[model samples]
Target: MGESVKYYVLLILRGMAMGAADVVPGVSGGTIAFITGIYEELLDSIRKIGPNTLKALLNEGIPGAWRQCNGAFLASIFGGIAISMVSFARMITWALENHPILVWSFFFGLVAASVVYIFRQLTSVSWREIMALAIGLGLAVFVSVARPVALPDYWWVVMLSGSVAICAMILPGISGSFILLLIGIYPVFIGAIESFNLPLIASFLLGCGVGLLAFSHVLSWLLKHYHNVTLALLTGFLMGSLNVIWPWKQILETTVDRHGEVIPLVQQNILPLTYESLIGLPSQLWPAIGVMFLGLFLVLGLEAISNNMSRCE
Candidate 1:
């Protein structure tokens, strides 16, 4: 492949990784963007889509606006995300249902390794960074433990929820799907996607676009002005979010979805032995460990490959 094609292909692959991550409620695609070294560029590109882009479109036509907004890059990343999410959603959902421990264990490893990967990005050790990390961690933990609320049965509420979820999705530690779950709209959103609910999808996408445009500017500014502190906060977030992906959990509450199937809406993390005793299911400890290691190594390997690629470039 040519150089540009190769680069876009790399982006697509990265997007695929992000999409896969986003499929699981406890994982954030933004974490994948950070791992792949595209987080800032993604923000910059998204932030460029405003008045200037409009001016470019009017004066210089589609090409100018496309160039202004880094259309190719955005398209490649989002295309990959779309394709991967569609492909992996079913598999991940099935795994979560049939083998919850293994699925959560694998993601636990991924996130754990991710914590190290993110922490290494810090330039210096200081109190501000530490405090930020503490705050982020506390906030993430609070969100994880918070009770789920009923999604308001209104079009505007759906749109508003989408906006909030999209913002959470771009934060390295926060899971957008988890946000949906918190509002009791996860199943509704998922069903809409699966069944092709056009109006609902349109409203959600509109909210996403608006949220992206507004949030990117602030995030980009923060990264530029407060790089280390921001990263520290994100690292803290990643650390605190581990609770969401803990391998062994006892369901504290359940609810019936639109499909009339009972699903867990509230759960408490538990030990493997405790899980076996209380849930009366095999802990699957050894296998979970194996899968967890696979996830950890997979992240480290991706980082190594990305570093090598950067050096070669």
Candidate 2:
């Protein structure tokens, strides 16, 4: 009983980590799952809901297959994700609103440490891996710098964005929110959530539901046949995304909408760090850096516990 409760808590924590990553532009919930050793299991469990399970449900009824294949586990994990996303959305949104720079700084540190952790996990560093890493890095950088498109505020576009973004959501190197931002749907999608607009939200979710089923097949195949290569690529993807999430920057340009809200469309400059900035940092930056270190230590502690648990197993 105690062990079961402990695992449940761990899963909830994992879901929260996933939620945080999904909220960011360059990070991914899938990356969080991969680093935590739950990626393959998650893919497999989701894949079970295909034809075989459907047939079983129709023929033997829901209860039989549900019990035989452990539906409760899937329900528990996904339910946790759903709960975390909905519950944390407001709090995260508020944090981003009130403390954008500090929040980004903490995540910046998280990803920086994550890149190191992932690099250390690689068993071999061949020329192929090197090339792959460079390619991944370049691709991520390109995406980060590309100008956002002005997409139409149509329901169809919203659905398309949701489908594509959700597909990207599970890939560690790809940012789902960034995908939306690139497609010019980021503002509307975020607006829907912010305003509690039900129609737009429903359309987006329907598309995401469809995309998840389609994407899971590809993910499952990669896991089964090309696990190492996939992980390597994902690691490269995460490493490349560092450029997008880098914290220090200023809004060099700004515009206002009809509603009189200032929209900063382009960031004209990134404030590169100097020795003086670190040594004589302002109070806000210093506390943010400390929080960044705390985030790093949290991941390291989780890694240590995971290693110990693996040894016991």
Candidate 3:
């Protein structure tokens, strides 16, 4: 294949990885983008989709606007993300249901490795950076542990949830679906996807469009002006998020869903032995540990390959 085709194909695979991560409650697609070495480019492309691109389309025409906004790259990435979400949603949900420990363990390793990767991005650490890290860590921990708030299942509510969730989805440490869960709209959003409810999905997508455009600008500005502090904070966010993905947890509370099904609401982390004793189920400890290492090594391997590719370039 030509170099251009090869590059686009890699972008699509990265997008698929991002989509897969976004589906999980504690994984961030932005984290995938960051680790894959495309986070800044992704943000810049999204930020380009505003007034300048519109003017180019109106005045300079389609081809001009496409070049201005990096249309081909955006299209390839989004196409992959859409395909992965639509195709893999059911499969991921099934895995979560049947093999929760393994699924969580794998992502747990991803996030833990990601924290180290992000931390190493910093050139120097100082007291101010340490404070920023602490703040980010504390905020993520608070949000992760907070109780879910019940929201009315209205059209507007769904839109609002999408807006909020999309913003979280793009942040390195935050999970958009987890945000939806905290707002009590996760099941509603997932149902729309699984059932192919066009109207509902359209509303959510509209919200996502608005949120992505607005948040991208802010993130781009922050990265430009305060790169180190922001990286530190993001690293802390990833560190704090590890609590959510930890494999061994005991449900502390349950709530009835819209379908009148009981589901876990609040959970507390526990030792593997404690999980076995209290939950009275196989903790699956050894398998989970093995999967965690697999995830860690996967990230490390990807990073090494990326470095080699950069050197070749």
Q: Residues 126-194, candidate 3: write the lDDT tens digits.
A: 997899899989999998999988797788888888888899988999999899989888888878899
How does residue 2 of candidate 3 score in lDDT? 87
Error of 2 at 84 (Å): 2.4
TM-scores for the candidates: 0.97, 0.87, 0.98
After best superposition, candidate 3 residue 186: deviation in angstroms?
Answer: 0.9
Candidate 3 — which pairs collide? none
Model 1 TM-score, all chains together: 0.97
Model 1 spans > 4 angstroms off: none
The candidate with the higher TM-score, 1 or 3, is 3
Question: In model 1, how large is the Cα lDDT of residue 228?
Answer: 98
Among these predictions, the greatest TM-score belongs to: 3
TM-score, prediction 3: 0.98
Alpha-carbon deviation at 14 in model 1, angstroms = 1.1
Clashes of each: 0, 0, 0
